[model samples]
Every structure is written in structure tokens, then in C-alpha cells.
Target: RRDTGVWDGRLGWGRLTHGRAADVLKNPAYAGAYAFGRAASSRKVRPDGTVVACVNRRPRDQWTVLIPDHHEGYVSWQQYLQIEAKLAANRTSTGARPPREGPPLCQGVIYCGSCGFPMSTGYRRADGTADYVCNRARSDAVTTPGCHSIAAAAVDAQVTRLLLAALTPEQVHLALAAADDLHHRHHRSHRGAELAVERARYEADRAERTFTQVEPENRLVARSLERRWEEKLAALAQAEAALADLAAARPVLPEPDRLHALAQDLPRLWDAPTTGAKDRKRLLRTLIADVTVRHVDHSRAHIGIRWHTGATDEVVCDRRTNRNPTQAVELVRSLLDTRSDAEIAGHLNALGLRTGKCRPFTVASIRHIRQQHAIGSKRNDPTGPGEITVPQAARILGVHEAAIYPWLRNGEMPARQDRHRRWCITWNPQTEDYWHNRVATSSHLKRTNPNYETGQAV
Candidate 1:
């Protein structure tokens, strides 16, 4: 619709400007109500002999010809008003407000329970992965923000499933009704355009007559009339061109059977990829007035949907994992020096903390968590990166720490002591290979037994 008839420049009809389109959409007449004296223009004379005019819209109560039920319209007056409010809410300039345009079904609807600010939408690296993030935890002094996010796919799926379950044929029927209205709307538009052309032609003719009838010596009045005539002709040409285009592009009315079939498959059509995000949102707004979401925890969100008819629906959608790594980092860093991996995991579970997959923490999970956050562990030597404690090395080597002590005293073992006097050894591939070779040659075995059994040295 942006470039409706741009096939060839000569015969093409350009689309309306953004401001003009918005004005047309916002007009109350489109909703069937007719009114007069809706706007007033005030002209101010400038110092340089130029006139400045400003138009101000008057309130509906001030209108002289206000009528509630003027004629049949595409939408009811109440619905038209709701659409206007929704449009205002959808504007990004309306900060921390609802009714935004986005793929995240709950983007504008969900407010942070903690700070009462509207959640914002973000996208993951992958396509179709949206995140509804609450950024209220942010502060000027603190570099780390307490903002939280939820995956959009799960939330959207839950909403869609719930919505489809609650919906009846009424929504589909309304859409069908709109389609029927559009077909009839063309007839009304054709008539209006024809009348406009007629009016413009008359004005053009009248101006031309006035210009011709003017005295030849009165050049000022003649020039003014000539300019008015030119303007009227231009208006007439525009109206005629629109009328021609409308006549040419008017669609043949679809058969009743096709409409019936389409209505029957309306649900399937709604689920189809052909239905765009904007249309889906519009359809949702028709039934759902507002949806409020509260983040109860990492995995769970309590959602409340308010329907226009004073009814409400509530449900909880839980994710399997927590995506925010900030919480895990802080928790693990505090517990690293005091607890073993298993003990730390137990503590995490006791605190009701879960991983990104929403699973209970395990020893390996704890180790991985510590590794990710650079937390020092018994298995992780603090001297250099990838260093292990003597006990850890002994376990890896399939021997006792006492065996490592003897080697350390004999100057055969390479190790370092930390501030706590705990021996640290680097366990690499070479370490394991050396242990395997020593075991193969029996160099690391205790000397005994053979002489005692044979009663002689062999």
C-alpha cells in the first residue's frame, strides 16, 4: 500500500503521506459518526506582512453537529476510540507504556513487579529468539544491573495456546465481517470521489468565469482569479485520477461459498505464516485488553490477562533454565573457598538455585560454574593456571598423597607451595604419561614380598 499504483509514472497514483494517513485513520467520520466545527484555524499577521496560520482541534463536546449513530461503519464508535488509545500507547515516545509493536507477545504488556517499569524487547543471536528484559535493577553507580529477561518463544507459545483455547468463532466472524465491509467500502469511496470531482470542476469553472468577467485594466484581481482557477483545475485533475484508479482496480466480489470455506478454516489461517505479527497483535488486542506479567522467580512468571468484558485469566509459565549468569557468578564466588564442589552444589540446591536448564546443581556443574567465573578450587591450583592440589594429583595418579610426599622429599617431584603451605602440582597430559610409564616399569611400586616367599634373594 506504500506505493499502491507505481507501475508507470504517468498513470500511477501515489500513496498518502504518513501524517495524512494518520489523520485519515484517526478521523471519527470513518467510524460512521458525522460532526461539524471540529477544528479551528487562527491566522496571525507577521511583522513582514506574512500571515501565519495554526489549526487547533476542538473537543468532541464543542462540535455543533455531533451525532452518535450517523450511519453504518466498519467499526463501532467504542472500538474506534479503543483503537485510538491503542495507537497512542504503541508509540515508542510514550515511555514505560503498553500496546507496543513487537514480536514478543508480552513486550509492552508485562511490567516488572519489582520496579513497575514496562519490560523491553531484545533479540538473541539466533533468529526468532526474543527476550523480554526488565532493566529496573540498573543504577548509575553500580556497573552490574539487576535487569532480568525471559525467553520470548516460551512466553509467546503459552499465550498463543491459551488465547486459541479461549477464543471462539466470534473473532473469525469479525475478521470476515471486516472483509465484507471493505468490498462495500469501495462503492462508498467511488461515490465520494465522483462527487469531489464534480465539486472541483464546478469551482474551476466558476473561477475561470470570474477571471474572464474581470475588467482588463484590473490586473491585480485578474491575476488572483487566474491563480485560483489553476488551483481548482489541479484539484479536479487529482480527484478525476483517483476516480479512474478506483474504477480500474475494484475487485470482483468473492463468491459466498469461498467466504464460508475461508471462515471454516479461519483457525488454520490464523496459525499460518501468512498471518503477520501486526495482524496477529491486532486480533489479540480485539479480545485481550491488557496482559500483566510478574516475575516470581528465575524460571516462573505469573501472568494475568484482562479481557475487555471484565473477565480475567491467570497462568504460570516456567522455563527449564535461568539465562542470567550474574546470579550464578556471585553465588559461586562467595562459596568457592569454604566448600567442596558437592557441598557447594548441595548449598545451591538448598538455596533453590538452578542452572540455565532449570536443573539442580551437581558437582561437575559446580566445577564448570567455578571455571566459568574464575573461582579458585582445590582441583584448580592458584599458583598458575591449570594447577591442582597434591591430593588432586594423587587421586589422578592413582596413588596416595603420602606417595607424592616421598617423591617431593626425594627431589623427584616438581611442586610449589602456596601461602597456606599446601603443595600444588600442575596436572597436564605429560603428568599422566609419566605416571603410566612409571607404573609400567614398576618403578613406583613398594619393594618387598618376593624374598620373603622364596626365603632367598633371586
Candidate 2:
């Protein structure tokens, strides 16, 4: 009989063998375990070679099992290729272009004629129109007085027109002729001076030689004469060397064609590029003599531009809405004054004047003004005698030394010093009297009552 019913219990299977199971399952662990059997039908024969049939039992059912073990995971070759492609793309993007170089000219070059300030540059309204603005005129803090802000475009246009007018054929010829004439005259005068100096030196050398010959026995006198002659000769050599150097350094006048080309192309060159193109400071110093900006109202200005030709020819342009010639001339005169830096600064400050940037007058600003004016002695120790030592004077004054230092250093204080290291502190006699009285009172208190406090002493 065959057992074909489903089995619910655990079941397992192993290799089956008919002839010697021990020989087929050599391992002891597999031999001891019973091999699960499957249901099957067996055929049996009759008395004369007949087959016999029998039913077999089914194998026992087994529960599903899970094994915990380490295994390697696989990635698609295509995904690896994509990752490499991304890395390469990133590197190519990063290596595209170089950084821009620094600007050729910076804000130090741009100047506002109206306010005498450096103009700042910026882009306008996200469009390509670049603008330069004066912060002083635009700021709320500048309520005292000044011109309104000017558009860079308008200023550039005005500058272009002015340049065109100034560099005209007639103007160019005049400038060239004037420059040539001045150069020649200067050369002649310089040569004459050189000859005079040489003649003077020769006469002095001859005189010294004559003196040495007459006083041959006088060793001291003879040595002095020889030294004088040597000094004179050295001076003459130095003068000649200097003259040679100056001649070598003299600028060769530009040819007519070069001047004409410059005149024609200057406007375009100035306009096409940004304001920071080339050495603008040197350019301005070379070309412009002075720029005078006069305010007609809050928003308008009249500019008078002067060139550096020997002749006094100037171009006047209305940069603002109104035109005022008289005011312009006054402004020009103020711009071209020959005064000490301090004097000029004080005058400007007193008049409530400000620089182009609308900042208060400073010592540096005054210095630049002085340099422009070419005023005062260039020699070291230009100060006259009798100036007081500032800190010492300040100590005596019972004030901060800085306050008095500026006064003394700038020649504001009339006090003088003597060889005894004593300061003859002098000022207006009336002011001196007040100080003297104060000193006297302080001294009296100090002497009579040693412990008395200053200002509290009776």
C-alpha cells in the first residue's frame, strides 16, 4: 500500500542506496540520518516471470530556514562610468578661465572740478551705463553749500567736447609754437647762466692762484687758496655735469604729425576705456594747468579749463544749467594763488570752503595745495628764529602738547627761543599779559602755600 497523504511535520532528505548504503554514504553524520523517502508504486511479476507492485510512503515536510552569512554586493559597470563622467565635468568647469587682472587706474585718478573731489565710479540700473559720482554733493551731511551731483556721462561728454576744442588745429599750432619758443628761450637763458657761472669760477681760480704766488711763504694762506680753488673747480665740474644731465633729460618736442594724431585720438581713447585707463595723474599733470569749477546753483556748474602752454589760453565750458563768468574767474584766481599752505587752508576754512570731496580741510590737503601753487621756500629750515619748543611751551601753558605743537610748528605762535635753552614765549602782548598774570597767581599760590591745590588756592 502507498501512503500519498500530505505530511505536516518536519522532513529532510539524503542520498538513497540499494546495495550497501554504508559504502555509498561513507561519512558517519550522513549515514546515521534517515533519508526521507518519496511515495512511489512498485510492480510485481506472477509465477511465470510476472512483476509485483507496492505503494511507498511520502517524505516528511521541513520548515523554511534562513542562513546568516557575509556576501558581496555588485554594482553595475554603467553606474561607475557615470560617476567618473561627473568628476571630469566638474574639473573641466573649474579650469575654464583665469581671473581678471587689477584695474590700471583707480579712484585716485578721477577728479570733480566743481567740488574738487575724487569721483567714485559704479554701474547704473543694472544696465551698461557706468557713472561717476561725488559723495560730498550727494550726502545729506553737506548742507552748508556746494554743487549738486553730476552724471558721469554728462561730465565725460563735456570733457570730450572741451578736449576737442582745446586740441584744435589752431590751438595745437599755437601750443607747439609757444612750447618751441619757450624751450628755445629757456635753453638760451640756461646757457647764459652757465657761461656766467663758469666765468665767475675762472676769475675766482685766477685770483686764488695770484694770491698763492704772492704769499708763497705763508703756508696757511697758500693752503686756503688751494682749497678754495679746488672747491671752485669741483663746483664747476658738478655744474657742468648737471647741465649735461639736464640737456640729456630735456623732452624732445613732439613732431607735428604726432601732435595731430594725439589731438585726433585723445578723445576716443579717453572715452572708449574706463576712467582708470593709463596714468591719469601724470596725464592730468602733463596736460592741464588748472581746472576751476564754479557753482551757479545747487545742481549746475561752470568749468574753466586751463592748458599748460606758456601762453595763458583757457577754455570755458558750461557744465551745469547756468553760466556765470565773474564767479568762474574768481574761482580760477583762488585756484591759482601763490600762498603758504597753512595760509591758504586757513583762508579756505574761514570762507567755509571744502575740497571736492566735501571733507574738512586737512594738513595733507593744504600740502597738496601748496605743491600745486609752488609757494613758500623749498629749503629745509624755512622757519624764522624765535620759535618755541612746542611740548615745552605746552607744558608751561598747561594744555595738551598737540594743540600747541601745530600752532608753533605752523608759525602761528610768535614765541622765540634763545641759545640758553629758555623759551621767550611771545604772542600778542595782550594775550601774553593775561598768561603772565595767570602764571604769577599760580606761582604765588605754589610758593606761599606749598600744599594748596591749583585753581582752589585763595
Candidate 3:
């Protein structure tokens, strides 16, 4: 019963609904504190000339009156504060993110060192590896270059090593002490539930005794007393059931010797198949307050670990190899000057070379790599030393580019198509004369003059 001997509009002795339970938890009065003006009411005029009243709950700082230790409480003030903190942390929006299920070790606790904001976890579809990216600029729609991103693997490995190192023998001893405290707390809570059950049983027995003592001839009094006894018996059963559940939910604590052995082999336990990502994250968050990471360069990243003990540690870890290997990029750059995108892709695939994402090279992928690295495509550049386009070949042979295409198609002229399927012919003084003679001797040939360099009009 939540009765306070006041005229509050509550039955104070019924099955509690979820909303009522939440209200009870949020009220500071239950924690031996007096709070006033926790909520504010306002009246607003609608467009239809109707007044609508609204009630908004205020923040703790905005409350009008608050007095600690105002009266006896169901829970201590410290427990109430802890409960509030936990509720705030569980909220996803505008609150600290709780540990979630994912492969990223520092998902919720990671921050961007550059912008000093929480980083978001993202996964690369190509390789399925995770990344921690500082998305402050993007999320806020600011006109600034976005902050850096670091691969999760390197940062996670470094933090894991640090965590294992911090778990020294002395630290294990302290952990055992914490475990002991937790066991005692659980025992005390269970005992409290048992005592409540005993009190409920006594209440039921007293109600039964009163019902038996009522006169059988007094029908009204006898019926009322019997009904009261039934209610008390029901309450006793509910209390006993609750106590049983509490006992069943209690965790079994390990012996000190076993805990020490497990602590010694902590690394193996962490990597065990039974361990899950969520479990690892929870364990990590217990010791680490937060981790800030920034990419120093392509090959290294700086990591800062802030522990729960107010101590901080910094480490530099080598970043994972770039998706596109240095050797692969160099090879692509070298081939871009001479080969078409298709030809380069083919050569790369033939040499057992894959892109940074470990996928076989494709024409589109090659083009993307070229554009990303600012390497010009062969088709975009003018003819190089021994190469000429169809237009150039046609100009030298005194024919239209369309006419040159026929010879190329018929294999009468040696040429190759670039990535876009445009013909490229080898051009030189000798090759030019050779094509001119071939054109002049062909029955399908036409010229402005029989003799070359006559400069005559058509």
C-alpha cells in the first residue's frame, strides 16, 4: 500500500498498474525527500479559440522545493539517486548510450578525440569490419570537413591489451572483495523478502482468527470478517511467491580460489566461445569510462583510455593496412597511363591481384580507384608516343574517321579500342605513309587530288 495518510486520489491498496509504479518510482517523497513543483501546468489557446491545459514534468534542477531526509522512506536517498542515474543512462536519445550488441569493443564509450564528441559505430559492407567515425560535422550539417575515422580492430586490440595488463594480482584481490560485497548484498535483500513474507503470513493468521471469533448468527459481521481473511490469505500467497522468485534470481558466487584461477587466465576466458560481444562490452564498460580515438595517419591511430578510477592512458596503435594496398595502387597508377580501365582490370585479375576490399578488379572499380586517386584515364588523355585515335589516323590518311572504322573493323588497319570502345591506332611517319598508300590503292578510296600535297579544292 502507498498510503501516506493524506487525501491523495489513490485507492492505495490495489494491484499497481505500470504507470502507477512508474509514478511511484519517480516521486522523491518515497526516498525520504520532499519535492514540490516537479511538474508545471499551462493553459494554451488553440486556433479554434479553445483553451487547452497542459502539464509538463520539470527537470530535477527546476523543481521549486526539495528537502532531503524529510521523513522515513522505503529506499535510502543514495539508492534513489542510483536508480535515477540508471534510468537516465538507459534512455537512448539525449542520454548516455548503454552497452549494445556488436563486434565493436568501444561502441558506446568511444569518442572522437578531434571534435570531443561521441563517435558512432559503422560497418564496412565490403569487408564487414567496423569503424568509429566522428560525424559531428555531418550530423550538425556544418560546412566544415568531416572529422576522421579509425578502424575498430586496432583500437579494440590496444584497449583489450591494456585491460588485461591492468588486471594484476592486486586488482584480482580487490575484485574478489567486490564479489564478496555483492554476495552479502544479495543475501540481505533475500532476507528482507523473507521477513516480509513472514509478516504477511502473520497478518493472514490474525485475519483468520478474527473471522472464526465472529458470531455465526451475525451474518453481516461474519461475512465481512471471512472476506477480510480471504484477502489476507491472497496477500500472503503473493508475498511468498515474490520471495521465492527473489531467491531463484540470486546469482551463485564463485569461491575465492576459483576466482583467482579465472583471473589468472582472464585472456582465455575473454576469448572463449561462450563469451558474447554484449558480455565483452559490459565487462569493458565496468572498468573503462570512455575511449577517445583519432587517426594520426594512414597507418597509425592515437587512442586515449579514461578509466573509472579517474586515471587516463594514451597509446598509439598501427592502423590496419589500407583497403587498397600501396603496391596495388602503384600498379594501377603505372598501368593507367598505357592501359584502358578494362585492360587494367583484366591485367590485375590475371595477376591474382584484388582491390583493397579483396574483390576481383572490375572496369567500374578500376575507374573509381583512378578517380579517387586523381589518376587520369587513358581515354581522357591525348594520344601518347606510339598511340593515335581514329580521328588522327583518318586525318593522316585523308579519310573520315567513319571510313577509318571500316578498315579497323575489317582488320585492314591494326588498332585497339579503349575502355569506351573507341579505336586507337599506332601512329608514326612510317605507319602514316603505309595507311595512305593502302587508302590510295583501294578501289573504294577517294581523294581531293591524285598527287598528295597538291592543296586542291574538292
Q: Write the per-residue lDDT of candidate 2 for residues 1-458, one digit (tens) a residue.
A: 12354644535455665544433322112223333233466787889996878986443243122122222213233343354454444453564211113231222334566567655666556434554556665665664255445444445455446656777777888888888997888798679758867875786679677666866679887777777777777777777777776666565788988998887777676656564434443454465554444456555565555567543333333333222233322443364334544555566677776764455565576555445545334243322443335544544556544555445556756665432222355545575566546656664322222323244553
User: Who is ahead in TM-score, 1 or 3?
Assistant: 3
Q: Which residue runs of candidate 3 sit more than 4 Å off their true CA positions? A: 1-51, 56-86, 125-127, 143-146, 168-255, 318-430, 434-458
Model 3 agreement with the true structure over 1-458: per-residue lDDT tens digits:
43465745565466779888877777888999999998999999999999999999999899999998999999998889888888788879876688787899999889887788888989988778998878898988884343777888878999999998888667889877887898899999999999999999999999999988888899999999889999999999999999988987887777878777877888898999999998889889989999988778777788999999899999998777445766667888888767777888888889898886678989888878878788765557455669888755655677655677777899877777655456777777887888777787888765433333344553
Query: Which candidate tops lDDT?
Result: 3
The TM-score leader among the candidates is 3
> Given candidate 2, what's the lDDT at residue 332?
31
At residue 360, candidate 1 shows an lDDT of: 87
Each model's backbone clash number: 7, 17, 1
Model 2: lowest-lDDT 10 consecutive positions: 96-105
Local accuracy of candidate 1 as per-residue lDDT tens digits, 249-279: 7877666667567656767977898887777
- Order of all candidates by lDDT, from best down to worst? 3, 1, 2
The residue ranges of model 1 lying beyond 4 angstroms of the native Cα positions read: 1-16, 23-37, 41-55, 64-101, 125-128, 135-147, 168-270, 319-458
